[model samples]
Target: MGESPHAVTSLPTARQAGCPFDPPAELIEARRHGPISGFTHPGGKPGWLITGYDLVRSVLADPRFSSRKELMNVVDFELPPAPPGEFLLMDEPQHGRYRKPLVGKFTARRMRLLTERIEQITTDCLDAMEQAGPPADLVTAFAKPVPAIIICELLGVPYEERGSFQAQIETFLNGETGEEELMAAYTATQQYLAHLVAAKRAHPTDDLLSDLTNSDLTAEELQGIALILLSAGFDTTANTLALGTFALLQNPTQLAALRADPALTDRAVEELLRYLSVAKSFMRTALEDVELGGRTIEAGTTVVLSYNTANRDPERFTDPHVLDLRRQDGGHLAFGHGVHQCLGQQLARIELRVALPALLNRFPTLRLAVPAAEVDLRPEIADIHGVKSLPVAWDA
Candidate 1:
């Protein structure tokens, strides 16, 4: 409860130059000082930043920390509550209400069922990349399309509508667009989802969205749920694919190890998830005065759980900075922890498991077309961290 001297005045934004995969150096330094550091949010409210693995995971699983959007006290102005069916920002029963129905749909077994289809998608993408010859932007040719198509099919979106749908979602999440463009993209997505949900109600199909239409959820709720699924399902995995490939090309030893042994794919994926931590930080507000990492989190205090730094905490993983494909210590918070953990994590794992190795096998000589430093990375302000365009080449 006593005042600590190591309060970070502001959240760190810039990652160390040329080290796209690591957390900002300031964060790593913060962790070295202690697991928890006092922090001041950009909006001028005081809070805490949790950088230790144990502390970050504990906060995620703790009921005392509320995820409700409106409860976040870091900002001066009161925030609106999350929309219906957008469970990520809601707590307890409301969160469970929206999440429970989807749990059965995204279970490991259910997701694995889509493996063959995902494999086909990955293969078809690689085929296009090959046909186009060398010097292809992997983001467009392979990474983006693979997840985009899979998610569209899962939501039963008509094949003809996917191209525009994908573009709109990209604009919504890319984080670089102006406020006007961002809202326009979001509005377009919402409108489209409304139409899609109505179509599903009148004529249900075998897809996840259609199945959800049969539930007690209304058209508006279904639209919200579909929006969450479509955005989360597409963006995170897409970034991981593009950024993971860039990471591998940078770490030839790890990539070569995976190439040498096919079984390493699973471990490699886990390690990559840990190393990249592309989704980055999440926020939680203290419901009551609580002690965390020897500090008192006052009631209504907001804390930023730095996932990337936590995943790299040396106490949690030995040599945490190194990307070891064969890493066995696998409890990383990339997909997150607790009740609100990512719903599509299993699907993501399957996509990465199949796509990365397959891409490697298909093009044994694949490497970045530009120099490592020349690869364009998404801005730190972006919700997802990844390459804007991963220009890659392979022997034709």
Candidate 2:
């Protein structure tokens, strides 16, 4: 195959074999091989993959690295620039303006209201799981639904309409589409939010959707904010539930520790986010041409921030490769750092802090129905690393 039209310069003929991301230990080994790594990404311009924690934080916090794709410092799937829609894709000033007001919704006090809702949703799901018996796919039965329902309630998306929304969210994320398809999904999501906002406008409620509708924000801004809350709020939490369960099941000591004292589960949840680093990475582009760590990034060059790699950087966290539920200062960029840090992070933390303790306490007998080697993992997905399915049984 000839070089892709998108390839600006010669890149490594191919990147690493197997998964570009693997377990924490394996990735530590991969990073030891280099600092700034290069990989041939299908037919696109080769991507620059950063594997260290401090480097990722520096790249993310540095305004010189732009998030604008047309600036083109990095490449993904060899695709062209994604038209602006999601706030996540935009650079700061613009990003900060849009990202500001929403911070009010994520405070510990505001997020505390979600605890009861999340627990109720979790319990209801677990009830259904027990009624169905053993050998269950936890992803579908427990992990996926709890967060979806919670987000729907938060967004005031009609509960009955959630299934279709869930499917569309997955489709938009699959990334196999040309830009048109992705844009359509984004537009469709905006229209849906616009309609929902209209509903809340006429008949407000005590939810984020209502607050968004009634806020002094414009229609487009409201829609963009709501869209992010719905998709990210659901997807990230679902992955955390599934992957965290896996970690607990595999490390009996960790599981037993949490079970023995439910108080420790909060820390376990932090460790899980750091360990799984589910949000993978966000992109950064160069604002002006700059050089660092021996690589020259031109004005508008794109960079991928490796969240997974940062969480495991040995320089930041001792025994970074090992899962320590009690580790303090988790010192991980799992939630990211700097101004663009996740707005919904406190909400996510609340969900896990509620879900895990309730889950392990209720399902003390929970164990994996499949071997570790048999579990399916997907690494190529943009911004998130997730299990395709997680099978578990109540073998107690």
Best candidate, lDDT-wise? Answer: 1
Kindly list the per-residue Cα lDDT of model 2 for residues 267-386, writing each as its tens digit.
888898898888876777667766655666556445555677678777788787677888986667878888778888888898888878877887889888988767776445445667
> What TM-score, computed on C-alpha atoms, does each candidate reach?
0.98, 0.86
Tens-digit per-residue lDDT, 1-396, candidate 1: 467657788864788778989988888889999999988898999889999999999999999999999998877899999999888999989898888899999999999999999999999999988998999999999999999999999999999999998999999788799999999999999999999998999999999999998789988888888988998999999999999999999999988999999988999999999999999999999999998888899998999999999999999998999999888888999989999899999999999999999999999999989988888889888878898999989889
* lDDT against the true structure, each candidate: 0.91, 0.72
In model 1, what lDDT does residue 216 have?
94
Candidate 1's error at 318, in angstroms?
Answer: 0.4
- Highest-TM-score candidate: 1
Model 2 alpha-carbon miss at residue 292, Å: 2.4
Global local distance difference test of model 2? 0.72
The residue pairs found clashing in candidate 2 are 65-285, 66-285, 66-286, 71-300, 73-301, 73-302, 74-302, 286-300, 289-299
